[model samples]
Every structure is written in C-alpha cells, then in structure tokens.
Target: MPFRPPPGRAAPDPRLDPYRERAGALFDQGEQIGVVYLRIDTFWRQTGGHLWWRRWSEPSEQVQGYIEFNGGGFDDFYQDAGTMVAEIGDWGHGRFPYRGEALQVRWLDDEESRQVRVSTFGLDDLQA
Candidate 1:
C-alpha cells in the first residue's frame, strides 16, 4: 500500500514556495508528476545471518528531473527513490506535480529504518 502521512501531518510548509512553483509550472505544462522522497537513516539489521547497516548522509545538492508517473503505484515511488539515491548517493528531496496538484517530497524516520515512505500533499493545502 502507498504510504499515508499521519493525521494532521499532510500540510505543506509555507516556505516551500519555490518547490511548489517549480512543480506547478510542470503541471501547467500538462505533465504528470510523482513525488519521490528518500531518507537514509543510521541503523543496523540482521538478515540471513548477516548484519547490514545504513548510515545517514547529507542530502545531495543536485536535483534530478521529475519522476515519470505510471499509475502512481507504491512500488513505482519506491523504485524511483532507490534510483535517485543510487545516482546521488544520499537522500533525495524535491517537489513533484501530480494531476494538477503540487506535492512536496518529505521524509520520516521509521523505527526499523527498513521502509521508504513516499507521500503527497497539495500546494493549495499549505498552512498560513
């Protein structure tokens, strides 16, 4: 299932106008966009008798083009996040315009640090 923000957590920050504007312009151009937010947390896990760990790193300065939207499946966003992280070697942050609504990419630290969370919120739904 696609991730959903906790109740009362869906509002976009007012300071994200630049991202919103960028995504809005793409929506105006008749393009479909999907938000991709990547988070790398510091943690360790044991799987198949092997230990794996991930260390947090600073977000990259480079921003890639909008991820193409194909039905907006949960796996699609997860794959996009993985690809972006592979390219930048860090967390990914950016806005994506979807179906005429501007959705910002944001992150949450999960308890196990095992799942990637991707969500969307409209630009018009920003708080004052």
Candidate 2:
C-alpha cells in the first residue's frame, strides 16, 4: 500500500481555503530582512487552532538551513517555524499550513472566516 487514504477519509485538508484575509506588516525598515514574524488570525476547523506565527531575523539568517521556530510546543504540524518564505524566488510549491495536502490559497482576505481560498500565493505576496 502506498499510503492510500481510507474511504470516508477523502476530505482534503482545509487550510487550502483562506477562510479569511490576514493583514500584517513586514520588516521593511531596510535595516532588517527575511521573515521577522507572521501573524495569522485563525484557521479553526481541521485542527481547531489559531496562528500567531513569528520569526526574528537572526545574524545567520541566510546561513542557517531550516530556521526552526523552537521555543516550546505550539500548533499542530507547525509546532516548529522556519524561513519557508525566504529565498523562495517568487512562490513556493505547496500549501503552507497544509503541506503535502492538496490545498492552495491565493489570498487570505478573511481572518475571521476565510471567504476565498486559492491554490497560489498572490504575486504581491511572493515578490522579491
């Protein structure tokens, strides 16, 4: 068996659906770069949780491999954080909060209840 999902378990992960749009500021002071921190309102369905993602630009920001968001136990699948968006050129390959799953989101317009979900990150969100 090649890891086939059982019957009735055919429902795909929902993070692909940006139920809401989240608005946050980036570290654009010129003094810093890379992901300073991210803050998502909530995606309370699949795992019943919220997002308050944050990551500081360390000195070895570029040199480090996968910047683990190590502190303590956090959310499911995303308990550890890292520079997933760093040096990704334009866009990434898979759904963020729902990696390896068939989910995609163009934008997150509703943080309370994501009204629109997409399979790709908006061009603006994936700019250099």
Candidate 3:
C-alpha cells in the first residue's frame, strides 16, 4: 500500500513516492538506506549550477555533482539523485557506480543562507 501522512501533517513531496517500494526492499535486505539533501543554484549564464549533497545517515560522506542547465528547467532538482540511489541499492546493493550514486535525494531551497540542515529520513527509514 502507498504511504500517507498523519492527520494535520503536510504530505510528503509526491516526487519521492515512486521510490518507496524499492527503498522498502532494500531495507528488508538490511541495507543502509538514507536520504540525500541537495542544494542547487544556477549560475548567471544559466549553463550550470552547484549541486552539493550528503547522506543523512553519514554526515561525513558529502559530495558534489555537476548540473548542466539546458533550455528547460527541472521538474525536481533532486530527482536524479533519488533515482541514482535507488538503482544503486537495487543493482549494487548500496554500492554505487563511479558516475552517480546517492541516497534518496531531496532539494533544499534556503534563500536566506547556504547552510542546509541534514535532518530527515527516506522511505527505508520509516517503520513498517
């Protein structure tokens, strides 16, 4: 069954729903499942932006990826990261390829400051 938020609580970002099942399977296998928070900001030329990410379960494991902004914008900036992590868990069992590897990715839009809070869990972190 799909997940639902508690009464009076805000719903989760719909973009992440697709990966819940996959993440659950990983959890059952005793894999380390976590979330990745990404902060993105486009450059003046709109060519690309800085993409910084870190695993929620491991604070010291932080990395950056390249973001090339073409003509169109992204439906969700963190979608790629989420998908990458899911695939890694499914195929590599938490071991990611050299190209793109991460936990369930969520975008951070903090205009006030560049600082980002590393709190929050992914699908696997939820108790069934």
Candidate 4:
C-alpha cells in the first residue's frame, strides 16, 4: 500500500477589508498626488496590518514591479521613519518611499453586491 501525505493547513488572507463598516481616509491629499498613498495608509491602520504596493514614478508614473512591505517587521506599518508619508514627501517630485509605482490594497467579500477590492489594482493577487 502507498503512504498518504497529511493535509495542508489553510493560509489566512492578508488583504484588508475596506467596505461598509470600515471606510475612510486618515489624511488629506494635500498639494500633491497623495490620495492613493493616504488611502492605502488608512486601510492598513484600520486593519492592523500591511498591504502590497506596486511602486510607480511621477511624470510618467507606471507600474514597475511589486514592493516588499513585510507586514510583520514594522511596529506601525504606515508610520515607520523609512516609510512615513512625511519623509516620502520630502524626497520631492516623483519620489516615494515605496518600491513600485503605486500601493495596491486587496481584499475579498462574499456579499454578492459588494466588490472584493479597495484599489483598482491587485484585484487578481492571491497574496500580500
């Protein structure tokens, strides 16, 4: 008889839910294109975790690749010195602390009427 392998455990979802009960921005867009950044930050803050981002540059801001925001490292995912919005803004035009073009926060919802995503991007992602 052949030996059988044990079943694998289910992995937890990393994306945050930003629908219905939890939906709001913590900071204003200010004078720059801070809408997307601020929104992502707010989501992580409320959810108590981090989300993946596709870093983009200004002028011709476009998706380059995935940014590694390791969720478990920073005490406060959005407030660390290296990744803070204030510090990012200081870098001047087109310079962001993140690696990719833009930060993408993804989530899922079983509600038939609701969509499973916070941002336009990362809808197809399977992990953080």
Candidate 5:
C-alpha cells in the first residue's frame, strides 16, 4: 500500500527525520524576531544518554513569536536552558520547516539578529 500525505502537503520520510532545517530557510539577512522551542531534550537514547536539559526557572508566556533560550551556555545537545529562535511562518498542513543537521560549528553571525548561523546546516520538512 502507498502512504498518503495529509490534506494539502506531502509526507515526510521516516528513515531520515530532519529537525530544524525548515526554520533556517525563513530567516533573511535582516533584523527579524521569531519563536523557537527551548527544547528540554535532544539526541536522546533508549537506555542512557548525555543530552539532558533543564527547564527555565522564570517562565514566560507563549506568544505568537519570540522564544528565548537563556540557559547560560551549552556545548552539547542539551538545549534546556539555552534559547532557540523560531522563524515566523505558517507551520500548517502537516508541513513544518526545520534544520536537518545538528546545527553546529557556527562561524558567521546573522547581521540583523546577531545570532550565529550554522556554517554547515541543512533543512527538512516536519510532518505531523
């Protein structure tokens, strides 16, 4: 049997699920505000792992856009306290943009937001 996509969008691949690739595409070379989930977990394992993150102490209200990751600093995938930006876009029709790569080794900084851009990052579609 052939798998069908939801409503108006195509289906995502099961073998390779790219996470944050889509969000990067929305960003332009200008000052723009967006929202991204300060994830509590990334690169988790079945038995044991090291990418465990902690939530923020001072909770903030969830608005249309603008999610901060002020969890001090993290070198690994544990993004509990650190902030991540969500590019303002329509996350609908079973299709959401995200980064496929781990988004590491930043070199150049985003001019507008002053956020560092991942030198070798890729994107993918998120299907729910």
Candidate 6:
C-alpha cells in the first residue's frame, strides 16, 4: 500500500520511532520547553538518529538544559536548532519566548571538547 502522511505533516518512518521517544525524554529531562520540543521533534523526524541528549544539573554551563551528543561529527542539529530559534522569535530571555534559553551541544567522540552554542541568529538572514 502507498504511504500517507498524517493530517498535517508527512508521516515519520516507523524505524525512527525510538529516536522520537528518546528525543521526547531528553526534552522533558531538559525541562520540556515547548519551542525546544518542537524543534527537537523536527530534528528527530528529519535526521532520524542525529541526536542523543539528556538533561544535566550542574552549577556551571550545563544547568537547566540538555547536553546533546552528535556522534556523527557534524553540527547539522545545532544549525537546525538555530534556525528554529530564529523562526520562533524567542531570542529574548523571558516568559514570552519559549524557554528563554538555547540548548548546549557537544560533539562526542571528537578530539575537541568545546561545546557549541545554538541561538537565534536573526530572521533577516533567512533567504526569501
């Protein structure tokens, strides 16, 4: 039989279901911010297994947010996060903006240990 998408969007692959579950858990662990959840869900649907993340409760940088690992050695998900942030227009830190925070992503198994910050760059930069 031919495949049909859901009411609003295309249907995601069944094989990628686990990734969605993990992504949901990670988002919840990271505090269940709505915009973040939507973006993360989009990322999961598009790339399948591009992310593996969990919440961390540390005093320093990894507080009240998620620590994501991209074993693929690329920042596609990070770029997606930035794009979503810009689209959502939730850049300012406050209640109006979704979560008022950006997610911290780390390239796992790579030589460098530095974390890449994803934030709203600006809508003007998007090509029309």
lDDT of 2 by residue, 1-128 (tens): 11221222212223322211232111222221111122222211222222433222222111111111223222222321124343232223312232332222232234311211121212123112
**TM-score of the candidate numbered 5?**
0.18
Candidate with the larger TM-score of 3 and 4 = 3
TM-score on alpha carbons, each prediction = 0.24, 0.20, 0.19, 0.18, 0.18, 0.19
Q: What tens digits encode model 1's per-residue C-alpha lDDT throughout 1-120? A: 112212222233233223221321112234533334332211221222223333323231222233434466432222222234333321233344344454544433332111222124
Best by TM-score: 1
Span of 10 residues, lowest total lDDT, candidate 4: 56-65
Give candidate 3 misplaced runs (Cα > 4 Å).
1-30, 45-128
Worst 10 residues of 3 by lDDT: 54-63
For residue 35, model 6's alpha carbon misses the true position, in angstroms, by: 19
Write candidate 4's Cα lDDT for 1-128 as tens digits.
11222223223112222222121111222232222212221111122222442322112111112222233221112332223435334333333344433332322233321221234223332234
True-vs-predicted CA distance for residue 76, candidate 2, Å? 3.8
**Top lDDT prediction, candidate number:** 1
Comparing 3 and 5 by TM-score, which wins? 3
The residue ranges of model 6 lying beyond 4 angstroms of the native Cα positions read 1-7, 23-128
What C-alpha lDDT does candidate 3 achieve relative to the native structure?
0.28
Checking candidate 1 for backbone clashes, the offending pairs are: none
Tell me which of candidates 5 and 6 scores higher on TM-score: 6
Q: List, residue by residue over 10-116, the lDDT tens digit for candidate 5.
A: 23222222222222222223322232321121221223223443222233212121132234322223332123333222232222233452222111223312232
Task: Flag clash pairs in model 3.
Answer: none
Error of 3 at 125 (Å): 24
